[model samples]
Target: MKYTEEHEWLRSEGDVVVVGITEHATTQLGDIVFVELPEVGAEVSKDDEVVVIESVKAASDISAPLDGEIVAVNDALADNPSLANEDATGEGWFFKIKPSDASQMDDYMDEDAYKAMID
Candidate 1:
């Protein structure tokens, strides 16, 4: 998995990538109350605002880290917003993307690098 400075996490499974906000981000936001997911088949650009997450403390935009076509969204989050707080990097994942440029992965931080940044 890789991470962006904006606190999104990404993991690839062939051409599709799983995406979510980092646990640190969810922690900072407090308990999640709502999620706005992208529609499947939507085209998105790097840095584009694709999702909205609202928590007890604040609402934040979850931006795309690479240009891609959204292939799946977490329908589970619709009825269970607190999943983000419970498992931000796992069951709480927000979407999946078929990245337009695989090389775009090179731009993100690996787990250690991302952890250090937060440390």
Candidate 2:
């Protein structure tokens, strides 16, 4: 339930998985303007490119933290990209996944490890 140096976070909600950028990423990207999300039912691999978040200064590719099939996407980001920057870990979530390999979750960092990487 933490993030990577690349700014992606992995959180599990029952069998579903949630992915999004970290607060650090938002700060670095500045004011976000657009978020391009993958379609539901699309398959994604660990570290695969799943989204594109555009900011006032740059556009960043949001990668997946584990291998999974996309089940849901945050359509709200299309109308309010700032939400990602405002609360990257909460309302800013980009996609929900149903992991193709549930055990792949073991490859991700824990909260302390993720925080240290960003700090």
Candidate 3:
């Protein structure tokens, strides 16, 4: 798993990459109440706003961490936004994308670096 400065975590699962906010991000966002995910098959560029999260504290947009095609989304979020708070890096994953350049992942932080940054 790799982590972006924006607090998004990416885990490569075979050919696709799974994306979700970090526990630190969830803590900052307070309790999530709403989530708006991008459509499957949408082409996205790195840094593009892809998911909208509305929490009790504030609304935030989760950006794409790499250029890719959105292949799947966690539909469960629409019904229960709190899933993000319950298991941010697991069941709360926002989307899976087939990256245009998988090497783009090399630029992100490893767990140790991410922990240092958060600390």
Candidate 4:
């Protein structure tokens, strides 16, 4: 998995890519209370605001790391928002995106680089 300085994480799963916020972001947001996910088949541009995650403290937009069509979303967040707080980089994943240009992944930061940025 790789991450962005903004706390987003990306992982490749065969042809599709998974997107989520890191534990760092969840922690910063305090406690997640609502998640607004994008619709399947919707086109999202790189860095576009595709989702909105709200916590008691604030609401943050989860941007798309690359241009892609939304393939799936994690509706579980609506029922269990705390899942994001408990395991944001894992079970708290936000969505799956089928990137229009796979090469865009090259612009993202690897785990080590991302860690250093946050640290």
Number of the top lDDT candidate = 3
Ranking by TM-score: 3, 1, 4, 2
The runs of at least 3 residues in candidate 4 whose Cα sits more than 4 Å from the true structure, single-residue gaps closed, are none
Question: Which 10 consecutive positions of candidate 1 have the poorest summed lDDT?
Answer: 56-65
Q: Using alpha carbons, what is the TM-score of model 1?
A: 0.97
Ranking by lDDT: 3, 1, 4, 2
Q: Candidate 1 on 5-115: residue-level lDDT in tens?
A: 999999998889999998899988999999999999999999899999999888889888899999999999878999988999899999999999999999999999999
lDDT of 4: 0.88
Candidate 3: tens digits of C-alpha lDDT, residues 5-111:
99999999999999999999999999999999999999999999999999998999999999999999999987899999999999999999999999999999999
How many backbone clashes does every candidate have?
0, 0, 0, 0
| Residue-by-residue lDDT tens digits, candidate 4, 63-102 | 8998989999888876798888998878898899999999
Q: Cα lDDT of all candidates, in order? A: 0.93, 0.86, 0.97, 0.88
How would you encode candidate 2's per-residue C-alpha lDDT over 1-91 as one tens digit per residue? Answer: 8667687888889999888888888888899999999999998887788898889998878788778789999999878999998888999
TM-score of each: 0.97, 0.94, 0.99, 0.96
Which ranges in model 1 have alpha carbons more than 4 Å from their true place?
Answer: none
Residue 85 error for model 1, in Å? Answer: 0.8
**Residue 10 in model 1: lDDT:** 94
How much is 80 displaced in model 1, in angstroms? 0.8
RMSD of each predicted structure: 0.7, 1.1, 0.5, 0.9
The local lDDT score (0 to 100) that residue 35 gets in candidate 1 is: 98
Q: Write down the TM-score for model 2.
A: 0.94
Model 3: runs farther than 4 Å from truth? none
